[model samples]
Target: MSEEKGLLHGVWETVKTVVYALLIAGAFRTFLFQPFWIPSGSMKDTLLIGDFLFVNKMAYGYSYASCPSIRIPAVGIDISAEDFCGVFKGSDSRLFGSEPERGDVVVFRHPTRGDDFIKRMIGLPGDRIQMIDGVLQINGEAVIIEEDGFFIETYEQQGPLGNTPMCMNGSVGIGGDCMKERMYETLPNGVRHAILNARDDNPRPFTDNSGVYVVPEGEYFLMGDNRDNSGDSRVPATQRGVGFVPLEDIVGRADRIMFSSAGRSMFAFWTWRSDRFFKAIE
Candidate 1:
């Protein structure tokens, strides 16, 4: 009988410890930094697929989107940020709000899908933005773009999604060289970063050239570093693209990459990109 009581007490103590640990972890994730894994090649070269980073949630203050979304398909758990902090939503303001500077890489919630997205902040509220002949134009002036050679990779399956990269050097068989025209683009604020163009010769009419977008107040314009391949503010939200994202949707700034893997799974230890560990984002 004494043994049974001892076993029950030990189980209860273990359960309490697990509960306490989960609560502490939840608070840390909610109020401080949140771990984010790059899942797409949109920010390539700058932020490659499988790159993992911790977003600084305190950078822009707390918003409803700051709450982490928990999604585990295998266990059938799918909770959105709205589910956790829906009451704090429905407004364009954030608690302890701070404006984000141009060229800062940010992770935010998708306006339509509520999924997380990371991109470089290109236009602030009330900024006139456009794309002319594959060049970024802000406030009636074109940003400077200096040619920076090429970004080359193997024309094969990449990351867990098994997506092939779009290449500037036309069609290539699997395992062949895939390349993109890389350039350093200087924003109006003097912040410069590398941008990739997959189709330099045949620029897309919609992406390379677009009508002027006067970003409304409390909204921001963001774009991927891989310019031609990104479906960003240039495209409308109705067309499955990230249009003008509200200020409240801004989650946090991605300051640095914690880890990176070139293979399909990060668990494949041999595929780790050791050089990219703790790499700073420009």
Candidate 2:
């Protein structure tokens, strides 16, 4: 049989080299860079909890939230981004779009829990946005901050969902020493980041005083620079928060931090962090 036709032509050339390396890694993760895996700290100390980052999908272009969404909930495989481009989603129009300034650090697509959510942008379209006592005002002024002080850590569990981290030198007993109140802010076209503040003595914590918002036009306005724990857009999206998002659910712009892993298993490479590897993401 001619050695079974040379072992079926060497298993059909190793299945066409694993289907051309999975179609060139699925067209380079569907039109360039996607990865992203911070798992939450809500952009703390500028995106922590595990870090990993990629998400540049041409920095705000394609639509249907730039497709690519596989979500592996312990083998369940959720799959979203409207199941890979839901007829290019209700049309907030994208495909080559571009416009997402106010302090960058994006990564969207959760207009209704379609998953992915990194933040930062902070109001745009029509602007307005509020939050008095805890600072960030915009369109009515007040975005400066300054006092960059404490941020400390290790009050025990963190990452891999262990959570626990809101402290202004409060309760912390699990291995003690935690804090918060770091400032910096700036944003008024001048960027400047770092903003955390765990309870500046409440002063009326409705996300520290809100109710202004506005920002409609094409929709934008994100948050979570750890501002008192961040649920963002000051809360609404039917209450769970992350309200005014859609700019076709903007899925892009995260800039750097190739890997970080503070522990709970990112293969636990000695719990990495190595000065946050590629870092950048400011």
Candidate 3:
């Protein structure tokens, strides 16, 4: 009987250990930090393809965690891994009571697709946003454009030498390559960033050129840092130009780039772009 009791106690102890480990992991994943990858060039120059980033889940606040009280059983549903990693729920409170600000690089659910998209906040709620002659304007005030040096190409195509279509001299293409002079613009409230210009007479394709858009109270207007190349709020909603992202759909603000890898083949871990490791997101 003594031996049996001891064996039962040992089993209980092992179960407790496993339970404790799982609880700790759940807590960590719930409120500490999370990882995300840059899947598109929308934030190019700041974040590139294959870039792995770490987002501070607690930076805003705790939503899914049992802070004020223990979470009720069965109340928390097992959504997909993405929703499980996120802190908030429903289309409310955005995240942790925090709100997005202009110039913040944020990750939010696509208004149309429900997939994740990362972009810079260019217009806040109730702000008048429009593009005038390829320049961003807010509330009748022009965003200052300061020229940075010419953007230089950093990588080359790997295909056959002549396979890539060559553009006529000074022809701008869909890919935001073909760099020209750039300028840094400081918004009225000190939100300053860079904007690019191709130095050609051709204008952007958007026809709504001048209009006063009062960003709805719960929605935000986002734009890509690569202005000339990005398909963002500048494009009308009908064409799916990221019209207005609801605050509740935001996941978290992008904090920093963890690592970046290059090349079409990612099988080799060493092929990562080592220089961009641990780079802070502006």
Scored by Cα lDDT, where does model 1 land? 0.92
Rank ordering of all candidates by TM-score, starting from the highest: 1, 3, 2
Kindly indicate the candidate among 1 and 3 with the higher lDDT: 1
Tens-digit lDDT track for model 2 on 216-249?
A: 8999889889877767777877677778988888
Least well predicted 10-residue stretch by lDDT in candidate 3: 159-168
Cα RMSD for predicted model 2: 13.8
Q: Which 10 consecutive positions of candidate 2 have the poorest summed lDDT?
A: 199-208
Which stretches of candidate 1 lie above 4 Å from their native place?
201-203
lDDT score for residue 263 of model 3: 50
* Per-prediction TM-score: 0.96, 0.40, 0.71
Tell me the spans in candidate 2 whose CA falls farther than 4 Å from its real position: 11-13, 24-28, 31-34, 39-48, 51-92, 95-117, 120-124, 135-167, 170-175, 180-196, 199-219, 228-249, 252-265, 269-282
Question: Which residue pairs come into collision in candidate 1?
Answer: none
Q: How many backbone clashes does every candidate have?
A: 0, 1, 4
Best by TM-score: 1
Global CA lDDT computed for model 3: 0.64
